[model samples]
Target: MATNRATKSGFAAEAQRKVNAKYSEELAQECLEWIRTITNEDINCGGDMDNFYEVLKDGTLLCRLVNCIQSGSVKKINNTTMAFKCMENINAFLETAKVLGVPAQETFQTVDLWERQNLNSVVICIQSLGRKAGNFGKPSIGPKEAEKNERHFSEDKLKAGQSIIGLQMGSNKGANQSGINFGNTRHM
Candidate 1:
């Protein structure tokens, strides 16, 4: 019946909406803004912003590159020979990593754009790479210095308040007790 078909179609539409809503609005906006700027200035992609926004939000690097190539950007390469070469290089890198005992996931494959049509992967890879690279360069601190910097929450653990009686004040012994002791506190 016509009513049955309509109900089924409506349900399908609602399901699609729910699936799409899983992606955050902030992420979608970031992708959209990046795509808008890149397509407008960097690549002369002829299509409307909506299409590019949607594709970029899905995060398919190959699709983005293809879009750029179609836009006739000098910076974007679109040859099958080049793609094959890149794939070979990627395979070599993976093999080298494996030999080196590097635990990397071999996720990327030769992208056959013609066969696989959907570009639904989110394109947040660049941000993650930046974070990893940022962490890789910093030198770690020693445990003692780290302990000195550790914060204590208990009132008893609080450092003793500033004391007038000390070695600086010509006292032989250092202040023995440690607590919230307010001793003859004078405002400078």
Candidate 2:
């Protein structure tokens, strides 16, 4: 007889750990309410089923947001459309920052704020809080930019960019923003 290697119910889902760190329950509730309310909106799925699904896969991610909302680890800023854009998903946690209350436009206007304020952490938080959030809209580098920088490209790479390859050159930021990465094809 073979020993049982697989277990049912996914090996008894991990137990919920107590939230040891301090968190604002009120803010989390507000964020969840926002997600729930949006779920019932035109963007939910029924209005533009295809696009909505394209944006928010099933209601599963939305549900996880609700749980985070109930946890009060997130908050809302005046509850406006722009606010929704900035803090709609896991990004809501950033809304708790005092500056977030100062209107989304101004708060996000300064690139320095994004860099110094740890916007990357906000992005990571969104990724962790929901099934998928930060992964959305990751820039894709194109072949043209790649050829412009790579200094040497085979026939394949040249054909991909309509050039002889290795003939052109470009700046790092230009190549990156173009979504060009010789090492990573996932962006392609």
Per-residue lDDT over 59-110 for candidate 1, one digit per residue giving the tens place of the 0 to 100 score: 2333343243233212333334443554443344333323333234422222
- In model 2, the number of clashes is 7
Per-prediction CA RMSD (Å): 17.3, 22.0
On residues 26-103, what C-alpha lDDT tens digit does candidate 2 reach at each position?
Answer: 333333334444334433323222332233322234434433434343433233324234234423333432222222
Q: Highest TM-score, which number?
A: 1
Clashes of each: 3, 7
lDDT of 2 at 4: 30
In model 2, pairs of residues that clash are 27-74, 28-69, 28-72, 140-179, 141-178, 141-179, 141-180
Q: List the residue pairs that clash in candidate 1.
A: 58-121, 59-122, 59-123
| lDDT scores of the candidates, listed in order | 0.35, 0.32
